[model samples]
Target: MPVVHHRCRRTEQKAEELTNARSKNRQMGPNTLLAHGPYDPHSLHGFVNPPVIHASTVLFESTDAMRHRKSLPYTYGLRGTPTTKALEDALSELEGADETILVPSGLAAITVPLLAFLGAGDHCLVVDSVYTPTRQFCNGTLRRMGVEIAYFDPHIGAGIADLMKPNTKVVFLEAPGSNTFEMMDVAAVCAAARAGGAVTMLDNTWATPLYFRPIAHGVDLSIHALTKYPGGHSDLMMGSVSATAATAAQLRETQMQIGLNAAPDDVYLVLRGLKTMGVRLERHQASALELARWLERREDVAEVRHPALPSFFDHALYARQFSGCSGLFSFLLPGGFKQAATFLDALELIGLGYSWGGHESLAVAVDLSDRTVAKGPKDGTFIRLQVGLEDVADLKADLEAGFAALAATAGTAG
Candidate 1:
């Protein structure tokens, strides 16, 4: 029986090596041909998709080999397989980071970086308009862990230096702050954090690595919620953190210690989604920008809160920092809750969903007056919109119906 099993193990390793070599040939990292990007041939899976691999126990060669604990490809399924590492390599190359690690979701992406860098008694300066979960985690988990989290205005920029204490360890940033779309000067924030000997991290989910490279502007780490755009089809949930060699080592170590590895299937889905992201993002950008302008011209709108728009308060900062605009934007409705609700309910094509970056449009109302400490967009009523790959004319017509509903509910002219 032992002899038979030994032969079986050898056969499996040979098969795996062939698979790994083929996969490596398909994807390129930082050194592929510039003209022809990495492209996969037609998938052989029955559904034209990569089959999900569920693995856990990875057998080793011998007791001697296992005892040394030396690196021998994938020792355990929990760490990763070729399918998973291929995705990680792809993300690392895209972001120009020395290394990348995947987490379960976008919030996981944020929390893990914070976890690796922060300890009890450390101080962290978080932007006032950061993703709400980040705030909750800081106030709830980080606070309980004895870490001090202080919220600061997104526009503080270089002035954030004032808030840094001697123990300040991290400066967390989110550009074009959630829902309200306020822009942040990443370079300015990094300058402030560096002077105080603090690490800087940002949720680069909006303008993905293709549009913005946070590390080039002095940020220590760049994070992306792959679920939104990178997983453009919305079929998978994943997050990534990419950093320079020095910082990547810390995050990688923490990722292993916390056992935060993602499933190989999720990684495969994201990798597939990433292949055509540029084209999809372009459509999303054009459609959303058109809608932002249309919203700005409406008398019912207080403002079209899109960083790509010239009328946006932080337009100049955005133009300087980013190469492209994303599908996400927000606008202030003429009337607060009553009118906003009416408009949302009257929509035909748009859905009332929590996430964006898919092939569909979504709307959500957010209020931040109570959460911000500094000049955050304290407004009457705010509504965020994610313009999908729909026709501009049809989307505009849908808005017309929504405005009519708002007018009827508020007893105002449309």
Candidate 2:
């Protein structure tokens, strides 16, 4: 057989196997995760949700199979179980990845893809406003490994073409940067990375695959902190990395070597979370939009960094690439940390917490002087908001109380 034919045949088989895993009844048996989740084939199980499989070990039948660890297929629990497989399969479908690997947290999601694609002496281009820990990983850990990390303005767009180096291995992007929420030109960056022979990875947690599919945008790999949206209840901590067929095999192998596999329960929880994510996101969006509109009209507010908002700096890019928006965003308060603290303390409905993506709204004071390099305002009180599934009117009332407290305490800066 010709080489082209041989390659095509192998690709077809892999695609077929992956497809079988998705349909819930195409012969791989009903995927327990998707039977009521994404892979509902019969549509007759009538269960509104997928069953949660909590298992550390999957027993195999034959001795030969046990010895080779190949009898029932997935050998050990860490390698993943039907539960993990179901979640992986479900996410793989969502992200359009040839394969997916689960990790313990959202940060793990960032580090796994980084470690998989980069090596000593290789160069990395990272967005400045990335999740702080991710920026730290590139500077601290990747630097320790002799890898060079370069920071380019997030809004550089196609001009990023100028930053490419011969040793550039990967380009890391986070749309609407974690704290400041400035949308980047995802397609432009991926195109430049492709021409420069570097893989592109995006931390797509802000929008999730439901709102934005990175694979369709030419990204080589997509990372998610399933802890946020996919694990919508915020009860489970999980991360995932998705890649096309060529890179997925390598990612899976690297994932095993690092032993960063997430627990089966986490996998199950994430799977369950995925079911209502679409609906939950709509709720989040509604509340967030109302809240952002309210903040924009606030006496102490300088700017709102929501992509869906017309006032956001990168609203144009976001409007171009994203199908819809999510609830996570930030805004600038007039005073610095003092006002942020005052407003947070005054809030009755929102919690002041380090982490977000929960049923309850959250607020935090963030400083961006060191991180903000673009045309963003120079000095402002940074407050990030994770708009939760709450009544917009109630959330607004809570914020109104917060503003009242801020006015009383800070005397209301224009």
Candidate 3:
């Protein structure tokens, strides 16, 4: 007879103990939950962080156990690992979701839920202000899969009910519509979708769960591009989908069947970032609001699209729904593409980048000409900025330089 190791017995005992304690720990506040809910110091020999378990094959001690792997905690790495579970649990707690699924990229988070709910002969209503990549996916892959897609104005609110088809299975939304920062009436749209028997999903990446709890506001499924706020460092790529108890089964099943998994290292990175996300986001929110206000007074700026600003058209709606804002907002410059290029080229401190939610600031020019249901800004060129942790005064000086470049370009054009 083979003797079992004492370490194995200790591990089993600790696992069982922690399993029983999870429900109690979940009742704690968000900050406590993010820091310690997912990890047990006793389980990992008093270590504060969970170990990165890079695994594919999980071995069983007995043939019977191997044959009945479905009863086990983890059967395979593609399904999940200890590292992945920690991140999922933490995210679920923050989002008020019954369960969460991790994916390779933020786009995967959006696409997976659509794939799970929609099939051939199904229709999906997507907001026109959705992320450009999401719009492309709906137009290309979902179209090829024989799913009908329609674009609706983000501000449609309760009017969304009139557009729902009998075959519509999903109503997708992104509040503070991508680039344009137009706020959607989430409760109104969600109520309308629920009446029509369509599942409601929102890309809550901008506000994250810290500032806006989507599930609490009637959203059925909440998605996050973890690459942005959750990751915080601009080094990792991951996405998460959180669902209410009633809808979690289908989402999990679809994810498993598709073999979607976030990398263990990236999962660990995100877990690390979550601890400091609260404070980092507070800084981001402050700097972004200050910059948005300053831009409103600029002669070169045509409009600022941050919802938190009192001057924003949808400020009332934003105030009603969101507890706080993040670092991202857009403004229109007084010139066309040429001036936009000049501004971008002249920036000294901010990087020209596509993604946001990093420690460093970034700037990008947006073109909304492709929008069919919503009109692009008629004033001039659209520019989006991600206000990072940099000093506000320094960032303002950088913008001054950018504006100077825009003026210089206009001078040359004349």
Q: Compute each candidate's TM-score over C-alphas.
A: 0.87, 0.86, 0.93
lDDT: the better of candidates 2 and 3: 3
- Counted clashes in each candidate structure: 0, 2, 0
Candidate No. with top lDDT? 3
Alpha carbon RMSD to native, model 1: 5.5
Which candidate leads in TM-score?
A: 3
- The 0-to-1 C-alpha lDDT of every candidate, in the order given, reads 0.82, 0.80, 0.91
Clash pairs, model 2 backbone:
176-181, 176-182
> Model 3 segments beyond 4 Å from truth?
1-29
Candidate 2 regions exceeding 4 Å error are 1-72, 412-414
Report the backbone clash tally of model 1.
0
For candidate 3, write residues 1-414 as lDDT tens digits: 134467667777887787787865656666666677666766776588988999999988899998999899898999899899888888888999999999999999999999999999999999999999999999999999999999999889999999998999999999879999889999999999999999999999999998898999899999999999889999999999999998999999999999999999999999999998988999999999999999999888899999999999999999999999999999998767877998999999999999999999999999887788877767688899999999999999999999998787778878
The CA-based lDDT of model 3 is what? 0.91
Candidate 1 lDDT tens digits, 203-302:
9999988788888898888999999988887678889999888799899889989998888878877877776787888899999998999889989888
- How many angstroms is residue 210 displaced in model 3 relative to the true structure, after the best TM-score fit? 0.2
